[model samples]
Target: MATHFEHLHAVSASQAYKATFASHEHTPSSSIKVQCPIEVSFSDDTQTQLAYFLRLLKQASQQSRWVTFIGHEALVDKNLLQSAGIDLNKVLVVCNKKGHSVQELMIQALQSGNSSAVIVTGDILDFTSGAIRDAAILSESFAFVINRQAKQQMTIH
Candidate 1:
């Protein structure tokens, strides 16, 4: 699968560290000092894109802090989440209502300093992504955005 993962961390990883998932090598979580937003663009299907999110959600759920997911209400499945080793009690799904954008809610959640991580799925404009990044930095937390692949040459619009 082709996965375009961006800005997952604020700094580069040590050369010695590695992870098994993709061609990308990741440092150990213990070694990571700065948290940031992760933007994922999958060149595969939605199923593959969701797998990337599932892996992240599972890791975030292990923390004692709250793990929040903004929007994607139609896709959240109890059985799937439970089966993925994600603790339901630690998870909170926020649906978009009351006329607020999903990314806006995500920024709020990240800056709140209450959750270990905030996740959402959609195309994120660079400015909004930067805001989310800054918010995550302030709160010392993680933010994630998962985007499905589009036909033709893809741009993060």
Candidate 2:
């Protein structure tokens, strides 16, 4: 099971890179920015989804760059992440409660050139597709947005 999960992670990482690079050919005069948006569908198995996300983060960090997560404080589990072999020191969590708009924080993180990938969840109305593309072009990192409300079903039956 673990091997299968690892294989899936590897495949996902490869696909992300391919999609990111395939979209842009000519090298920008400034820096390399890869736009990779990973969407997490809402499900009863939040832990499973979280584990998969952590795996993605670990893969991104393998490039020796930091991973910045901007979202609600309850969305990330430090203990679970540490258990997954991710270095807490390399992870930066910016809570949405800090009074800054989540979108603003995301933009700052992407443009700061300090993170390899920025994972954003919750309240992403400010992150328009054009804005994300522009940010990716201006920074040296990848951006992933988690759709926490995706696949929501009203009927319990």
Candidate 3:
């Protein structure tokens, strides 16, 4: 798939870019990091999910980069992921309680190219497709956890 940033830039209005880019206040050292959020279902013994995370984590660790995780429940799963071979420091946890909006987190991740991957919970499902698309435009890969409960939110209508 095309990088998130590419997709976003393709559709984002110059005004929107000016607003976001202006707020960023780029510095001489400022850099852009790309992230692509992938949504994965969490089921019994999520070893496969954990393994996927671990593989990415290890690769990023090798490059001295880290993966930032969003959500409280996600953090719990990440703990289990450690057993699958994740480096603790290479996995930074940021719960929603930290009072960061998804957009804020994405921007922070983009600025910190040191993070190779970013994982967020289904809470992000509430964002407008435009926002998610924009995030994809800015990221290399993005991971989203779509819990079984989330599917129940759908109506038969």
lDDT tens string, model 3, 31-82?
Answer: 2233234444444444354344454444444445666776555554555566
Which residue runs of candidate 3 sit more than 4 Å off their true CA positions?
A: 1-35, 45-47, 77-79, 96-99, 127-142, 146-157
lDDT of 2 by residue, 121-157 (tens): 6533435455555565466565666665642521223
Sort every candidate by TM-score, greatest first: 1, 2, 3
C-alpha local distance difference test of each model:
0.57, 0.56, 0.47
Off by over 4 Å in 2: 1-36, 45-51, 96-99, 123-126, 150-157
TM-scores vs. true structure, each candidate: 0.63, 0.59, 0.52
Pull out the clashing pairs in model 2: none
lDDT of 2: 0.56
lDDT of 1: 0.57
Question: How would you encode candidate 1's per-residue C-alpha lDDT over 1-157 as one tens digit per residue?
Answer: 1222234432211111112132343422531133445554444333344465566667667777778888764234788779988899998878777888777888888778777768676654532457877787677565665553331223232
Give the Å shift of residue 134 in candidate 3: 5.1
Q: Candidate 2, 26: how far from true, in Å?
A: 26
> What range of 10 consecutive residues in model 1 has the weakest lDDT sum?
11-20
